[model samples]
Target: MAALMLQGTGSDVGKSVLVAGLCRAFANRGLSVRPFKPQNMSNNAAVTADGGEIGRAQATQAIACRVEPSVDMNPVLLKPQGDRTSQLIVRGRVRGTLAAARWREGRAGLLVDVLDSFERLSAGCDLVVVEGAGSPAEINLRDGDIANMGFARAADIPVILVGDIDRGGVIASLVGTRAVIDPADAAMIHGFLINKFRGDPALFDDGYRAIEARSGWRGYGVVPWLADAGRLPSEDAVILERSAMSTGRRVTIACPITPRIANFDDLDPLRLEPGVSLLMIPPGTAIPDVDMIILAGSKATIPDLAFVRAEGWDIDIRAHHRRGKPVLGLCGGYQMLGRSIADPHGIEGPAGTVEGLGLLDIDTILTATKTLERVEGIAGGARFAGYEMHMGETHGAGLAQPVGHRADGSPEGAISADGLVAGSYVHGLLALAEQRAVWLARIGVDAVGPDHGASIDAALDAIAATLERHLDLDAMLALAQRAGHAATNG
Candidate 1:
């Protein structure tokens, strides 16, 4: 199989988005394409069709390729849980937790599993586009690295280094990478590309050439800043820091950005609504008076609940609830809205009980077993489809008034006596137009937004078109073909 890998000069350098675009661009040519990430560290995850979880970006890429997401797409997922520890997932299922001390050796041992997934995925695809995590320039981490040059060498795939020109120092970043990496590793990078270039591409002609001359690698193309990318789901939490509140919308919805936030993309659909203004309230800032407050998913419910109280967001939420404004919680947020949370197995931390925000008449207990599945159900008299990926269980009088019903006729989530507070384990409910419309009506905005799934498809097409225009597709195809031949022959 023909394969090309995209490695970035640093994190958030647009490697994921570029790979997704290339996947779509190649798929448009009627070629079978697949996306592969040997390892990824993210909290925003998607439940795959195989009943497992992977980073959300891979799921988006699968959609771009017009395929269902599989655990093979992202074989190794590291979900950070604070205190220098991460929940390690191998081939979709949780293996255990990896601490900072064991990070190197722990990941090194997973190379076999990663390659197995790669080989399996390659068997069914004509071309595979691989995305590297972080940079190869960190020589200290090069010892047991499986996410960059190590994987590239193991798979014998050609690489194209990407630099974010929008962040400046593009010339230095690309050249600097070549300057620091091992000679054998450097040889794998056949070319480089400038990403997120603002303004006219012509203005950076000299800088682009300078990188080529200094790094001794050919230039692929200079990609302009993509406006459509904002319409897609983001994998990194760093974006939350840079997120700004949208203005001029009729209804304001506030979401407090908690530490270890996971699957916060639940708010993405609301952002599309013309009448809804979604504001991500960062720490040290007070939660503003908004029509609704949504407590998003969290990786560590107990710790994040502490963070919420420490940041005085708990006070803000209470005041908002007293004002009769709606408050919704999803997954961990749902657990946090209960009366108390018990952790007997130290699943998240030291195995203790903690008081919740008490917005609803419910109590929760963290469990080792995790639920991962796609589901469809009825909520607010509208049919909705989404997935459930969460741990623990909640029960109380609130269960009598569920926010919705699962297709199996079981209660799905909790609703307050006053009907102003609700919590659900299901994510992506608002992505459906009917469900979004129902939520919008609660805030007195009767407008229905565009179909979110269709909008995402259109955004993917727009990005593919942009890449087709700005990137050298023929050259990339040639590189991938050459690498494929070499891998097969060896």
Candidate 2:
């Protein structure tokens, strides 16, 4: 099989985006190309056509490759829950939960499943560009690591290391990684690409020469940071970047940063609204005086609550509530708006009870059983489909009710007594344009949220166009084919 792997110097070094770009670039050259990640750790996941959940980055790459996203693309996914434990997903389905130590010991066998899927995809595609996870030189994790050099070595794939210059230490990161990686893993790397560079490329001439000499690798090129990357919906929640909301009658929802945030993409639909803004406020940033405040989804409710307290955002939220402005929360965010959140089992943090923002007069108890479901319902006279994945049961007085019903007409979630403040287990309800317009109209704005699926498709198309502008994708595919041929001969 013809396969090429993109390894990184470190995590968040723009490897995911580059793989997506390369997938698009290769597909544009009339070659069937697929994107693969042997393993992924992300809370931001997308529901596939097969009713499975996988990392959003692979889904985005699937879109770029103009192929249907499947479980095979991301064979193993790790969603961090709390403590040292993570929810393990195999082939886009929840396998079970595992602590870090146990997971590391068990991961080698899981790679067999990953390679089976990769082989299936390779059989059909002309080329497959696999994206590696984290840094290859994570020594402690290397033995069982299936996402980096291990996967590449197993598949006998040639690797291209990507370094993020914008993060600083581009030289050290590249040199250090090459120096520390196992001989076999290091040998797999055929070249290096410098990414996210700003200012003149000419200025980095000396640095590029230095990196090539020290690392003994070919310098493919130095790519400038693409400012228009905001046009795409990011799959990683931690890299949230604030953009200006379009001027008009807009309701800006301020999301206070939480440590273990999940599904932050819940607000992405609002981003498409011409007159609606979704502002993510990090700690220490003053809550902008805005139309509404939205507490976003979180994985660790109690610890995030503590973070809210530490940042003094608790006071800002209370003040917003007193002003009678509408406030909304989803899942863990919902738990935080309640009067109290109990975690006796310490599923999220130190065993204790904590007071919530108290905006909803509700009480929440973190439980061992997690609810994971996808369904459609009416919200404020609009139809929408969303999913609920959480480990908490919420109950309270003056709680709002869900707008619609399931097949049995059972109440699924809650809303406020005044119908202004609300909370729900559902994520992605706002992605429905009609529902978003109804909410915006209440805030005195005649805005219509764009169709989210269409926006994603457009973004993918745009990504393909951008990558086509740069990169010698045809040559890359030729290189992969040649490498595969060489491996077969050896």
TM-score per candidate, in order?
0.99, 0.85
lDDT per residue, candidate 1, 1-490, as tens digits? 9999999999999999999999999999999999999999999999987799999999999999999999999999999999999999888999989898898876788899999999999999999999999999988999888999999998899999999988888888999999999999999999999999889999988888888899999999999999999999998988888878777888899999998999998889987788888889999999988999999999999999999999999999999999989999999999999999999999999988999999899999999998999988999999888999888988899999998899999988999999999999998978899888887888899656777788889999999999999999999999999999988898
> Where is model 2 more than 4 Å wrong at Cα?
101-106, 199-214, 241-251, 274-277, 284-288, 306-315, 338-370, 392-400, 405-412, 485-490
lDDT of 2: 0.80
| Every candidate's lDDT | 0.92, 0.80
Model 2 over residues 262-298: C-alpha lDDT tens digits? Answer: 8888888877777766677876787877888888888
| Model 1, position 393: C-alpha lDDT score | 82
The candidate scoring highest on TM-score is 1
Residue 67 of model 2: what lDDT? Answer: 91
Top-lDDT structure, candidate number: 1
Candidate 2: which pairs clash?
Answer: 400-414, 400-415, 400-416, 401-415
RMSD of each: 0.9, 3.6
**Count of clashing residue pairs in every prediction:** 0, 4
Evaluated at residue 157, the lDDT of candidate 2 is: 92
